[model samples]
Target: MDTCALFHRYWALASESGYGDDLSGQIRRSHGRRPQHGSTANVYHGTFIPNGLEVAIKTFPSTLSGMGDGSEVLAGLKCIFREVHIWSKLRHENIVPMLGMSKDFECTISVISAWMPMGNAYDYVQNTNNDPRPLLRDIASGLGYLHGHELGPVVHGDLKGLNVLVSSDRRALLTDFGLASMNTSTFNMTVEAIRGGSYQWMAPELLDNCVATTESDVWAFGMTALELFTRAVPFPDCHSVANVVGSLILGRLPPRPTQESTQFRLTSTWWEICTSCWRRDPSRRPTVDEIAERVGRAMYDTAPASFTASSHAYAPTMDTMQSRLSFTGDGPRSAPITDNDNLLPCATLSGLADKILSLSFSPDGTQIASGSANGLICHWDVHRRAQVGPLSRGHQHWVRSVAFSPNGQWIASASYDGTVRTWDVHNGVQIGSSLQGHQGKVFSVAISPTGGGIASGSADKTIGLWDVQAGKQVCALVGHTDKVQSVSASQSRIFVSGSHDKTVRLWDARAREPVGRPFEGHTGMVWSVVFSPDGRQVVSSSQDGCLCVWDVRNSSRVRHRLEGHTDEVTSVAFSPCGRRLVSGSMDSNVFVWDAQSGARVGASLRGNAGWVRCVAFSPDDGRQIISGTEGGSICIWNERIH
Candidate 1:
């Protein structure tokens, strides 16, 4: 059908069907003065005469008259023509429905659709407390529908958060088809062009001067996820375009958001899917159907309590929940081990000359290792509550953190001397010359679950993966801008790091690079990060006075931020079952929290007269909790339940 003929037929059909009067008559009655409305391409919100069904009218500017050859103007007209052509055929609930288009060259080339009152998804995240999973699902569904259409696969050249429009019913609709194209092959547009593309969301291949592909669309969807969760542009910290492209080439990603303003935070599964989309190899990117499935699973896993509410109904106020905020205590206080039922003081290792800085129970629970401020790493017999062997004393500076290898044969310790050393726990002898690389204080060390290597994070703003047997620095994972305070290795490939940069970052120790984006929610230095037993989640404590439990497999977002400590949280450890989290603080108390809900389980466990520097759950069965204090005391309390 011809363009003018099709337009006239569409208008006639609308008028006859009571969808307001014909386009020309409506324009005439309104005196050609359509109200300026929300726009993407000169689209104006207007009333349709008597019935007044709200509509958005997208018009092509007539300024093509003054330009020399009018090629620039010609391109815009072509874009409008393409939008109407492509949009008029799409009939999915998640896709914006086109009402009609006008081809009157005298006025302007225009296309019209239903006006979306809620505006873009990016804006919606900022103003609403509504859960965003449904919106993301809708976008993925719409994109999948377009790609799986019987005619041909359609490529949305641009699919950032801004391109997604939110309807009055809160349904997200994929709009702006200016750069879209139907293709039979994989990559559609082969022209080496950066024009009309969102650089921040563009795939690395596209940035490297390739064409738009279905895979590239998937990449943009991942970037859009970052925007929806973070409420900011991709790579918000990277100020220049050059830096963004450079980061992508070097395999860096946007930081995960830590905000609790939303009804549901992004899950670890969601983040895993998102990062997979941004993989450097475009061929490895997931299809739209796969994306939809992943998003569906994430929604099912992390659905909020308010998921069934109406669109207009906002999430309930969290003030009551906020009462459990960390730091709501009455000054500095202490509680005894016997305060709660079944609780007893199992053991106390006293008479140490210097304060204990770190504590770790061996895998078999037969021994406990304590790193002291006196540059000594002592192994104590857990059964007898006595020091067992000579101290592994080679570090010239205070030992900040310590961990026992999975096999319980070696102890890895981080020290202020800027070195990470592994020692034979059996003989209390230093394993080898200090594993040196960091130029500043080594604050934390974690032995891999395989016990083959140790990972250390230091004040030098780097994480070093060292081979324990070989005693050599393998690679330095450099990303954090501030001191790397704590490092925790998962059972397999991943490791998590918390830093003074106020972020928790995921890394692939095997690959020696960041896995996904850094978790960027803490307002103060993140002092500790620990993975759950299954390596599916991460728990981190910060000077910000919040303990954040993050889903590590899906999204790196802070799933729960437990509050109650008024002082800096020094250490956090997950129970063996991963159901509970124990945190020690400078407030001189140890608190336990429900990992899933971020709620306090009971009153704080207290005994230390000074700040609690470290904490560990007994590896045997979590029936006991051990804490190292600044006052040179190690307290072990038997767990009891009523």
Candidate 2:
């Protein structure tokens, strides 16, 4: 369909679905907006609507698919849904996220993501002949983490040029893992159950053994590693590699002519790693950690490698360059607001030996409160862009967490000392009290919307409720079998807690009993959780890097899984309007996303020198953003970029 026709149908269907009435029109201005993208999911980039973001949007089904194609639709949705689930499990620097989804027959799944201005690695290979080493390293690191890290063994069953994204700086990242399988679950999946992967990069065993094993994956990675350097896929030239399936089973070895040069010397170490990985015997393959150890050691021993991705992957041969926010960096930096033209003054808060940790806006917007583990809570006057109050102190340890009460009169700080301390918001004086019932370090804190109490989550696997006014411990809500990483107030009706135990619990503050049932579906520790605007939608973040938005009213995670943020999402806060969300993480950046649209609003918020410990919105002011960093600095980001 043409743009007009698609918009017409979109509006028509949206009206019929009643979502037209609910359209956050915050995105109304983004109507008819489209993403500037390279080839991947075949669809019109222009026909989609912005989900309150600039980089990605949902495409209107002009016609890459069909209606009677119900099976295709169902299968595609399943694949997409599976992609959502799997990607959530693998978060790293080179991997983007795909979180909770929203879909309509007229539109494909929501494209929740930040911008990648340089396009994909394929673009680099097509445009430049420079070496793709940095990206290769990043890809290797990501794949390594997947194949061998803390929660890895994640097999990107389908690794190809198209799935590798290239940043403007030529940094490469892996994308489109719809067919990727977790290493831990590979044994549970049969080849017959899902013969998913790119034919060109398929390991010989995938055809012979017909099972996911270390060797098969290593073989695929070896080929992928080669493909990265050569930019050559097995198709068109190999006549669809599927034709060689039988030969693979017959144990016929393929030739790999080494290109020897000090520059391109496919030496013994290289071959040892590659050949071992591709060895017919899975036992011979080196894990990602092993590869990292050797490669990292080699790099350390040798001269520093240049950003080869720039030389080979990001050559300035692009015929087109398009971006909404004109970036100032020669390379694409994460924070979109960092544009030199839009640069905000640095007078907000400075003179610290650390990064900013948590940022919160006072209800009146007169003060912006920032808390950092530097053992100080700094308050900045909005108009003056200067410190307004004495540095709030007391938590000797890094203030691991902080929250502002709904009334804006109190600020709660969860510390490394395993105590929750209250500070007078205006005076910056300690409340002269602390909640000391927990034996483990406090990890998170939340203020009840009703303004009567506070909820503190600890590493001890318990959540303690306190009467803010009474300044006394109200009750201990316990059930998580492991460390409680996060807690959120979903109105006074329900309180949600997520834990390392791999379960999310919902409790009624009034009834003193569990609500409905535990919302389950994560395979790793749940790290961040928050309530959606209406109080019915609850969003939880996990080590899997997936954010499952749940329907609190019905006690079910919204079918959509929010993915991205290549690290544990340590903190999450709803936008003042609740249509947007901001998440902080160990990755040292913050991501602001449109709740309904799933589009990252700006570049990932940066300038944090260390792990971003917490993120919070100003109670009434939407533009004021406050973030606390591990380095003990608080940054106040006013929505206005220079």
Candidate 3:
């Protein structure tokens, strides 16, 4: 496809995947102004206005390496696809996260990421103080993660001030690795290499065609450190690129920063790190890894490297890394920044535990299990509000139901693809699959109180007993004339199914036959059925606006006509206290009813704009109701109502 078509195709895919709004907003706040005009790659800030996320979008100009403007047409569509392959292999924390790449590299490739709201070190220095020593330590730690992590030694060729992104927590992230190469003139050491960096802060070796070894990077780091502290160009008052070049060739290095009296003292320890960085010999400077260890030993008791080990795997090896630096590889002089302390701070978003689809907390109120659309299930971390997964998969489709075993260790999920899977909630591993021979979707599933196996109701008009581990049909109880919409299992070995049969029937899960009677009450298809927490009562909701609470042992309806739903009630659950019943309906309301009196309690929550897909109470804070909507939003309501 052509570039224009390719761009539209990518936009369509991005919208479908939900990756752009989540990841691209991260890159925008971290980027500074473009280093040079007409550079192949231009960096811009992207703020997610509505989602409250920020990201960076890096665009590669049409003509790469200036191979003659006429050669632009030679770059084919496959060439853009090739760039995607290159970026897809790259993953790191100190490095920027790659969200989704557009189809064409020449268009705009955006990556969403976490924001560093504290602002870049360059801005922090000029705005807060000329000597940003605390900031320098953070910068070292980040580079240490990148270069030392065994993920492959990533040499960020463009390591000047403009590209060193800062995190709000004051940590530094070395970005823009797309410019790096395998240390050759063609790879990175050519004049065209000046495409995306601040020349004033570039090490001389970067301009003079020397390999951008770790040592050369150290020299650039030193110049960046100087700029970070002083808010001044490495060479002050040069006025223009011509004047700076004249001074450099005529034997002038940017004036060394003189020690000054300030709140943050620039002691000999600081001078040692910075001056050694500018050593004329490439072999004379420290690798980013070495610097992080020494500085960390001085500040935090143990190397913070241990903490950031999660960020990059190379942390263990920074202890013995070695590098040779070069100072004379030089390049064209560049103009300095006109705005020193300006910072348009980046935005931040809390990381999600997973790509959540459908979530549910267990009925017991002690544990919560969330079933993901990816065919896995996760239990929530009560303290962190994040998901902790022992995730297991057994279903052929997304999990639709997750009911905790009476003891709370096992959970079952009904699947659209006709299977009921049980899981060991503590380890996130599948314990068993109940593969009943159903001709259609398993619309509802429930576990027996004895914890032996499960009963699954399906569109095939049959509800069956599934041997929990062997994953086979043990018994088939068939009576419904249409799809079995819902099922409820009780401690008395009784399973009740509500269906388009317009009735709720009692089946003995182990006896291979229907129990004493089938209670006919609804005028339309049944939608949901729940065993009352007491096990003696069962509440069933249907397409007809009636909810029936039946006295299980007697096979009689104690309340045949619980009312008030304008539409089918899709979900029903009893509160842990067992005295209150909660039900969610397609009418976009959640109602709580007094279980004994059959009276509605709390007023319906009407804020949901779409059908309430899920309603859950916090295991720790039961009064707080959390609802998930069809529009892809989760809202927590802390209000307590009676």
List model 1 lDDT by residue over 1-642, tens digit each: 234343354445434544322355453223365554433446666655544556677665552434434444444444555555567667886898877655443445566677786678998777433446667888998999989876688888899887899864356999888778766433221222323587799888876566687898999999888788777888888899889878988878776666453334667787798889888888899998999877755653342231121222221111100000011233211132221121111111221134568899999998889887668887876665555666687888778888998988888899988888888988889877889998888999988888887889987889999987788999999999878889998888788999877899999987888987788789988989999999989989988888988887655466887889977798999999988889998777788787878888766766422467789988889877888765455766666664
By descending TM-score, how would the candidates be arranged?
1, 2, 3
- Model 2 residue 150 CA deviation (Å) reads 35
- Top candidate, metric TM-score: 1
Q: What is the TM-score of each candidate against the true structure?
A: 0.46, 0.45, 0.43
Clashes of each: 13, 31, 31
After superposition on all C-alphas, the RMSD of every candidate to the true structure, in Å, is 23.8, 18.5, 19.4
- Ranking of all predicted structures according to lDDT, beginning with the best and ending with the worst: 1, 2, 3
- Candidate 2 lDDT over 1-642, as tens digits, reads 243344344434433533212222222223454544433353222211432232333333422255445444444444444555566565565786443233443445444444454566755654222344445555677777667746556777777666777753244778766567664442311232346566666776566437555456557766665565555654334464555665556655445544532235234555566566666676777776676555433321122112111232212111111111122334122222222121121111222223344566666767766655346766666554445556677777556667777777878888767888888877789886877788877877878787777788887778888887787887888787777877888765678888877788888887766787788888767877878767867777776766777777776555557777765676778876788787777666677776876766656565423456667776665665666554333444556433
lDDT of each: 0.72, 0.59, 0.56
Of 1 and 3, which scores higher on TM-score?
A: 1
